[model samples]
Target: MALTVHSRFHPIHTDLAVVTLTGDVDISTAARLRDDLAALLGDGARHLVLDLGDVSFMDSSGLSVLAGVFPLLRESGALALAAVNPRIREVLRTTGLTRLFPIYTSVDTAITVLRAGDDAPS
Candidate 1:
């Protein structure tokens, strides 16, 4: 399945960029994902909320892209994941990446946390 990425500034919290992704994130799509993420950061998004509820699968390449952008977000902003599917969650847990991201149950919750500056890495 082809990956689709939708990016926009949070409606209420302009400082936060919300990216909603669907389909599989693997070798074929990791680069695009990385580019999109980098673009958001470069566009001056200080906080990000990734909504992964529609994403069905993710592989190592996808994880790598996420990890690569993590430090950038940490240094200049905040990053959070919302509505992650089970498959992706398992991958993150197995790879011990769960500690690097703040995972929330919903996009609204993530937006709130990020807007309040509560999702910063500890």
Candidate 2:
């Protein structure tokens, strides 16, 4: 099955956009993923989190989408991955992107971290 992505915006202390993915993320849906994510970034969403707990499969194409967004997110100091399964994490690790971004075990963790960062004194 092809990947289906559902995106929603949550009003956290800091601006955040969460996109949840389900089904297989291969060549067929990688472009959609890229477009949707890039749209979010374009809309001024700085803090982004992708919840991939429901994604059954992913490929290099999916990894490419993630990688392509990282630098753009970094340019504004935002973006992270949340609720990624071990299988996908392995792929991210193999791509040497594991340390490039913060990986959280759950969406709650991602929100908490974001909230904390927002609350921290600068």
Best by TM-score: 1
At residue 63, candidate 2 shows an lDDT of: 83
Candidate 2's C-alpha runs over 4 A off are none
Whole-model lDDT per candidate? 0.88, 0.83
Error of 2 at 18 (Å): 0.6
lDDT tens digits, residue span 1-122, model 2: 87888987786443588888999889999999999998887777778888988997888898888888888877655677888889988988888988877899998898778767877898
Query: lDDT tens string, model 1, 2-93?
Result: 99999999776677899999999999999999999999988888888889999999999999988898888787688889999787898899
Q: How accurate is candidate 1 locally (lDDT)?
A: 0.88
TM-score for each of the candidates: 0.92, 0.90
RMSD per candidate (Å) reads: 2.4, 1.5
